[model samples]
Target: MGGGGTLFTYINKSTSHLIIPFEIAFKYEEKGFKTADAFIAAYTEWVGADVLVTENRHFLACHLDLPFKVLTAGKCLNLI
Candidate 1:
């Protein structure tokens, strides 16, 4: 949904829920912002909810510097 090097922030006011889902369809290089991290930060700020990121273990580990727990789920889950 965004170009490379562009940092975006999204906020949800209804509830406290942060979810980050990365799709395999998109090609990812070993550079730039990992979709997981971006989603987590944005979700956390918007909803003030905990973050849930479901993606390949390797990819998630490479991008996330903070502590995170992996969950088994699809990438097309509810975004907000």
Candidate 2:
């Protein structure tokens, strides 16, 4: 963490290998967000974002195998 700040900016955005929101809408429902919101969340996870900035605490219910971190909007800003 040093004085270099967060390396979150180095995160990648996946154009391919992204989950199809329509194809797996039902599975996202288990996370408590609507289909549209779930799509965004799913994309965030697929993109390998360093942090999934969200105001929706319901994302905590997402049990998907995630490789990134999740933070509230405020928390994300603080890190920046």
Q: Pick the candidate with the highest lDDT.
A: 2
Cα lDDT of all candidates, in order? 0.42, 0.63
Candidate 2 is scored at a TM of: 0.51
- Estimate TM-scores for all models: 0.28, 0.51
lDDT assessment of candidate 1: 0.42
Off by over 4 Å in 2: 1-6, 10-26, 30-33, 60-65
Cα TM-score of candidate 1: 0.28
Tens digits of lDDT, candidate 1, 23-60: 32122323454665455444443443344445656545
Clashing pairs in 1: 11-46
Clashes of each: 1, 0
Off by over 4 Å in 1: 1-31, 34-40, 56-59, 74-80
Clashing pairs in 2: none
